[model samples]
Target: MAQPRKPASRGSRRGRKPTSCTQCHLRKQKCDRNQPCNRCLQRGVAHLCGDSINSNGGFKHSQSPQVVSIAPPSPSPRPRRVTQPPMSPSLGTLFANRGARAFYGSSYFGHQVASRILSEEGQDLPAGISRGRDTLQSFRDESSSFAQVWDLLGLLPRQKSTVDRLVNIFLAEVNWSLDAVHEATFRSSYDEFWGRRFGFDDLANVDLRWLGLLFIILAFGVLLDSPPHPTLDVQREREEASLRFYWAARRAIVIAPSFYGESTDIVRAGLLVTRYLLYTRRVSESWLTIGFASRMAQAQGMHVDGERWRMTRKATEQRRRLWSHIYTIDRMISLALGRPYAINNQFCLTHEPENVWLDDMDDEEANRAVPQPLSLPTPSVLSSLLYRLAQVVGKIQEKCFGMERASYEAVLQLDANLVRWSEQLPPYFRLDNPDTAADDALPFLPWHRLYLHTSFHFARIVLHRPFLLRESITDRFRTSHEACMSSALADLKIRLRTMNSTNADSLRWAFGAHNLFNSAMILGIIAVKNPHSAQAGAILEDLEAYCENLHQDPWLNEFGMAELKVVELCISKAKDSRYTSMTAYPSGTPPEPPGPRIQAVDGSGRMRPSDLESPAMSSDMSSIYWPTVWEDGQFTFPGAADFSTWEQMITGIAEDNYGGQ
Candidate 1:
């Protein structure tokens, strides 16, 4: 009792306001019981009222505390108060400063200093400005400043040094927007300064070798942008410069040996010489140059003797390699210009009728047909040139034949035999296929045969007078003829086996029928000229039978039909017309009549013969017949008939004008 000692009266107990049960028990804080206590409610924390303080420490209200106030605590010291500095002005703004900007824009030292500062700060600038800096640096490194000289003489620097410095400057400015400046400077100083210094009388007389060296240095100077520079004109200038240097070096080699003792340079010069000569119309000269270059390369151990320059092993392989690259480049140029490359000797043989046909034969016949020394013409200049050309082309073709080496030889033999075949056919054996027998045989025989004949004819023409065929001429004809023949044979075979099925019909539809007639015409030409030995004739007859069974096919379009008509006409003329009554025409003439003339207007508005000419008309009936009749109604024996018609035919066909016609 004395126990609680009357737990000192509430206010007097601690000498402070009495604590609320909520504060003392739940929150453990002193509470006055004011409307909102500073400790809890002011902090937005909820306040709970304890049972109203029991007067005697006995219950005066519910056991659990009652709510007095409701509030939340202030958030913890706002996350450490971070701070950041303001953003700096962009490059544009800095450049926009009136006083400094004008100085930066000026061409004087102020601008240079500003550029240096900006560059140090890693800022971007116009390419021209950057290029100017590069050029200045290169010049500084290559030439001593005028300030370094003890005397200020009025005389100019030596020509060689001046030229070197100018070239160096040009090279330095290559990457800059200084192209205009470089060009202007180059043009102005080239003749009066550099040209005179180098002992050149004029731009044309400038040592091509020196020019080439300069250009090579320039070419290797600047780095190229992959997508290319934004300015195509600049790119083009660079390329042209490189090519000029290359050509100059090449010309120097063609003219004379390198002045310097660098064998590599000499090799490069020779390669270029060959390339330049090949690109020109001087085919003979080009070949000679190439030969000389090859020899030089070999002598210098740049190339192996047996390998030419193409496949070689040597310490100076790079120099040897240049020859191969030059050869290839020149060849391409020749093709583009429709000029003949020295290596294109196999020209008409691969594409001409005679050669192509011969190429399509069995190896035995091809091997047997190789012209012996007796058969081949002796090596005169023209013959020598032809032989060289042929040898080169033959080598190329042999390589192309790859695994099927025999194929090329086969084709060549077929071509060679064509002329002989043409000479053996009888005059009375018309090409008409009464039983359509020739139709079956025609596609296979006539095209192959004609291909050979035409090829030989072209070769003779080129030998007598060289002319450039268009780049795609041979390829176009070869592809078209091959397609036509392939389709026809497939159809003929299908027709022979399956007479009425829809599949057979479809195949026949796809395979042209006119091919049969075309093939037969070709065969007839070959047969009529050579009454093939019985064995050959039998083979041809069998081939003919195999070809005629295809249905009325449609692949033979109007143009193809026209060609077939021409073939038929030629076969008929050969067999029926007693004109020359010759078994075979001379080397270059065809057996057909020339058709019509095509013309074009010249610049002066006058009519002139067009690039192409029409086929020639047949000789007048009287002219053709009277002589034969007078001589005897019987056909002239082989080599006995007047050859005028044959000559005219050959001339007409061989004329460039008659090409397509």
Candidate 2:
């Protein structure tokens, strides 16, 4: 239920009010006042049965602080067991202070912590009282109530231990987008927030903004929980839990308009909404959400350098960091969809963040000084580095692949620039280099390094593959196909190393899968063309190993495996052709290759085509085969799949027969 926007106040009672159980009894009416009596119970309300402790018949006037009631057990009862009703509103009058809920015990009302956090028992807000909503929300010194700070614990797992475990799992597994939510505030609230109740959040102290942000973080945590629960079971349970918190946070945003205000609180929560969409396979939805967040961020003047606005040191750095993340998100989704960038570099003038160690910033809302460089890179430093790298990636995607097509020379230059970018990364950022940082074998080194290398290879493929197919046209149109193939082959080698190590689990998820899947078809084609090469053999081996993990996700896995199989089949045919040529040429020398051989095979994969369905001429006569599979993962035309179909497709030499064909 949405919270009422109005504050508690003594307003005119212009509408119908209910008569209490005691009212009918005093009037000597046979009211049948069981709990509410027949009169009040007919309205489906659990009417308070106690005598009026106050002139207002148990309910406090809008002028006073409202608290929950503690109704006593009824004297007469003979029926199936039921959950007891809420305390009578009159009972609350005995308590001198409004903070009465703190005095109650769990057993006193047979209530559980889950009930306190998850279930909405005593609180009820009027829905759609359109005319009265404004009257109630009118100005007051303080309108804050339990509704503004409700415990959404019911939205989490029923087991407290399970919730804690998932929290750990979430933090560990989630690819922290923009590294949202400072670790300190989130942990601080988490420690004391659980011991709190609806009206008694001791730690939060009525900071509804922080509480709302906590829920968003927990939602992401739930979604990223993996491994511990096994595969499918964990996925199902975590999804349910994530969705629960996702709604809770989403509801908080809509109810409290303050969340969207110019506070650091909104920065993390706002971006997570888009992050959540992407994590859940809602790609299209994520794009819209990210775009919305970018607009909100720009509205807050985040596009300008924080220092220029004279903001706090921490606030300035945070804005720059967040905007960088937004830009990265725009690049990732835009590249995926082939859409124009939302964060155009031409307009955004915000200074990029510097390499400040994250550990130093852990408790740094107070420290006004700029952070200094660490002996080696930290997560914070890595984040800034990645942001800058993603900027380059976005620029390349937009300029080279979008509206402007780079010439062969420009492509070569860009490739060299990527190499230089990798070379320039700080010592710790380059995982392969034998630096002092690796003397002890960094804990998360392999996981991060694999991602870095994979992304590098992906950029190379994206930059170079368009020209690989055009290489056969003419020297002018041709580009270095070997460079493209070599880059792809290098990616396969790195993938093999990753899957063989402990980091393989994380590799199968999120952008990890995206980076790897983009090159599957390209590698398959390379393997087919050079099936006997040792390099090709290793790649095909690792490709099979990688596809095994993808089996858990059917959509991408099936398509990926299908394309791999096409390459495998093509390689097999190539090997058979080589064997046939070897026996025909005995002197260890082979005859000059013929221009193009054609064959015809029918429905049984490699047979003859039906008489009525006479084969037609193929578009690419220069192509060695009658038909071919293009680099875009599509077959050229009908009968393009089986090479044998080309023989029967040929035209006769005679003029009449040639015309007929």
Candidate 3:
């Protein structure tokens, strides 16, 4: 069976190497080397077999190996399969741009997009790198671990009574605005959750989104119940506990793997997170998070009327409530920051939530259950009313503040719409009703009433703020001026009431702070421009009270100081004005007093760009009328014509210095 091996031919001898070819040497296998080695030919790397390609038998620095040799195939040769190197699998083409990646430090490639491309391309990533599917699978696996779930639950106060109290606080004080969680449904789930935690059921079956909802509730309770001015140690303890609960909530949401989640619970959790972010003064982050939650809700077709999809009655009502809440928050946050909102009402088909109690929705005969008339107040009446008002606010944002200068006709129309909304309110909820004390018996009604009035007044301010300047002042514009001032003063009274109420702790939040700050700014502007007006004393008193209130709230300290400085600056300017004794202008336009005197052909007291040729800017900085401090910390009067610039300066200070916090 065995014959002596034939002597190598001259060409075969020339082809055979003394050592292994580069491919075989690098692979550490025996090589029957020729121009193309036997191993290379078998592995389909015959074109890569050359000893001179790499002297030390290591790989070249090139991204891909060089093809050094290829032999013509024989007739009827066996099919060859291409094999990749064991050490480095082929990555093929990257989805990300190399230049952009280098410039932007790798984050230029979004995780979701990159993961999708890599998965499609069948690409290999380096060790420990996580792809999207890998991340989701890990989350699912971790969620199955009872120990991990238990560890998260263990971070909370263990007493059932304590937990109940916390949940009750959130439900009573905060949930009225959000209505993200239904009390009955949440209570039922919470009971089952604790049962599972205590081993009555499987922990693996627990819903992380609902668990996160509970954690968010606890965080709110801890934050809302903390004393106004706690001891440093106590404050620190409270902060740590609140943050612990908040982060646990966030972790639980991530474990729910809510990135692609479209469930009501996940969307509700996201909504609550936005609210929490807003309360904590992370405004921009809240805006971004709300957008994410909006997308999730939209993915579930929550933006469209659920009836069109023929969903269950209960599901329809829930989607409606949640969508209204989402839209409201989106408009509020976006309008507050002068950013565009996520939902355009024109494209949305979801109906407003019916004025029905949450309990009524759970009725077995829900289809037969009738919604309460708007004439009667229900538990959800506040939410229903707010939803309606938010619609008006959204319109105002679009018609009035949406452009550089809205037409007077559009302003009147939006103002009328606001008036109609107010007039339609029930007598019990009417801001103009003398009996503010009547609603105290109803839980959260007093608070809701205050909120409703403050929002209405704030809307009035926003609707008319553009024309508040002296340059824009005229008899026709007189209506806007009065509206701006009256609303500002009305909002101030409400603020004082809130500070004195038992609900003060719950009301000490940034949502109302923005309203208060805007009101204070408007009042300050009026007081400086019209120092001799009869209402000046009252305005200053209110502003002083506001500053005091701001000083008391730890969250509002910086804003409070900034407001104080502005108020003080206005008062000083008023006292120094030569027209202190002059009565307010009958036409509602205040006289512009002489300041850093730079004469011009137009003695209209309005400064022009050419007026800057004078040495006023370089002159002594001490004497000017209501001098404005710019971003660079330098004071400039600029002129009466530049009053809008002053407003911008103040707003800029607030946005730049305090908005992020």
- Writing each residue's lDDT as its tens digit, candidate 1 over 1-661 gives 3655455565332444345644334434466665444433332222233443556644342222222343445664333332221222122333321111221233322223322322232344321222223323432342523111111111223355644554554444331211112233334534543524222111222333334434333333321211222255655564454445444454444443322112334444454444333322234455555555544444343333223323222211223224343333333333222344543332211111111112223445544543333222211111222222333334333432222222323434433443343343322111222122353433333222222222233222211111111112234224323332333333333334443334213222222212212333333333333332233244245344533332232222333344334434334443332223223444323344465332333342222332322222223622232211211111111111224443343233323222221
Show model 3 residue runs off by greater than 4 Å.
Answer: 1-165, 176-180, 197-204, 227-229, 258-260, 358-361, 434-441, 472-474, 501-505, 508-517, 553-661
lDDT of 2 by residue, 1-661 (tens): 9987876455434364444344444433345535545543432233333342245335422121234354556786445444433432222222121111221222333222221221233333121111122222321114533334434434555677876765665565553423666666567767765655543222123344444566676776654444433566556675666677877776655443332233345445656776666544555566776786676577567787877777666666767778887877777766655556677777777877765533335335425445667445444554565566677778677656664444456667777777787887666556355254563554454445554666666666666654444323235423446666766776766655544222225323344424423454566545444443456556666566656655534223233445445444444443443454456656433544444223332322222322112123444443332222222211221222333332222211111111111
Count of clashing residue pairs in every prediction? 48, 19, 0
Best by TM-score: 3
* Candidate 1 lDDT: 0.32
Report every candidate's CA lDDT: 0.32, 0.50, 0.61
> Which digits, one per residue and each the tens of the lDDT, describe model 3 over residues 1-661?
8999988654343454447776666645677757676665544444456764444434433223433344459887755555555423344433442111121222322222232232233344332333343333443465533355667867879688888887887787777654658788788888876764332333434566677878878887886677766787777787778788888887877666422233577678878888777666566678887887787678667888878877667767777878877887787777666668998777788788887764445536667777888666665676677788888888777765554435577778888988899888887788775355556655556656766777788777766665554233225667777988988888777766666333334443344424323566678766765555678777777777777776665544343455556655555554433142433444443444434222332232223344323224545333322222220112222332344445444433332221010
Residue 34 error, candidate 3, Å: 44
Off by over 4 Å in 2: 1-154, 159-161, 172-178, 191-266, 270-285, 358-375, 431-436, 439-446, 472-480, 500-517, 529-535, 548-661
Local lDDT at 34 for model 3 = 76
Q: Tell me, by lDDT, which candidate is best.
A: 3
Residue 192, candidate 3: alpha-carbon lDDT: 76
TM-score of each: 0.23, 0.58, 0.64
